[model samples]
Target: MIGYMYILQCSDGSYYTGSTKDLERRLQQHQSGDGANHTKKRQPVTLVYYEKYDRIDTAFYREKQVQGWSRAKKEVLIRGEVDELHRLSECQNDTHWLERYSSAFGCAQASNIIKKERKKDN
Candidate 1:
């Protein structure tokens, strides 16, 4: 069966990641507050991103991988900035660049880094 890994932008401006075999039905469930507990509390979520996979397990695995990602990384994926992913994922001492950059300066500074990287790519 086909499967899909998805991301939802919640009413609270937070993100919720999930996987489903039936995207439409699952989205309806979430909208009706019959979804995950997290989505239940943050109803009326908008589907922000998704990836289709050949197997449900593959989609589930991808969901798990994305769930561990920082918001910046997820945003890059959501925006389809595939090139930025490697730049943002650069790690040192087991700490992701975004995590370190964010803690060091701030999200705005991190955004600057992304911009700089984009310029370099171009």
Candidate 2:
């Protein structure tokens, strides 16, 4: 099943990141204050970025990676500046970025797809 990693820019200007099998329903939940506790309190968030994955685990892992990012890094993601994200993530051990995500997000196996793709052709 296809799943999505999404970024929401909240009414209060804070950002929230999450993953779900249904992006529309999740967004609606957040808008209606039935989403995550963080977003529920923030109330009325606008979806600003999303990435689709073939597996729910992949999406969930990406969500965790983005959640730990700085606002500027998230903004770069929202703006589609993938190079910037790479630059930011690469500053570490080149693996820490994704490692932290895989460990925290409970989808290490699925996230390997993204890392593999990155190692290919680019």
Worst lDDT window (10 residues) for model 2?
A: 91-100
Instruction: Report the C-alpha lDDT of model 2 over 4-99, residue by residue, as the tens digit.
Output: 998998889999999999999989999998898899988788999899999999999998888888998999889988898788777554366567
Model 1, position 3: C-alpha lDDT score: 98
lDDT of 1: 0.91
Best TM-score among the predictions, by candidate number: 1
* Residue lDDT tens for model 1, 1-122: 89999999999989999999999999999999999999999978999999999999999999999999999999999999999998888774323656777888898897688668769979
| Maximum-lDDT candidate | 1
The stretch of ten residues in a row with the least summed lDDT in candidate 1 is 91-100
Residue pairs in clash, model 2: none
User: TM-scores of the models, in the given order?
Assistant: 0.75, 0.71
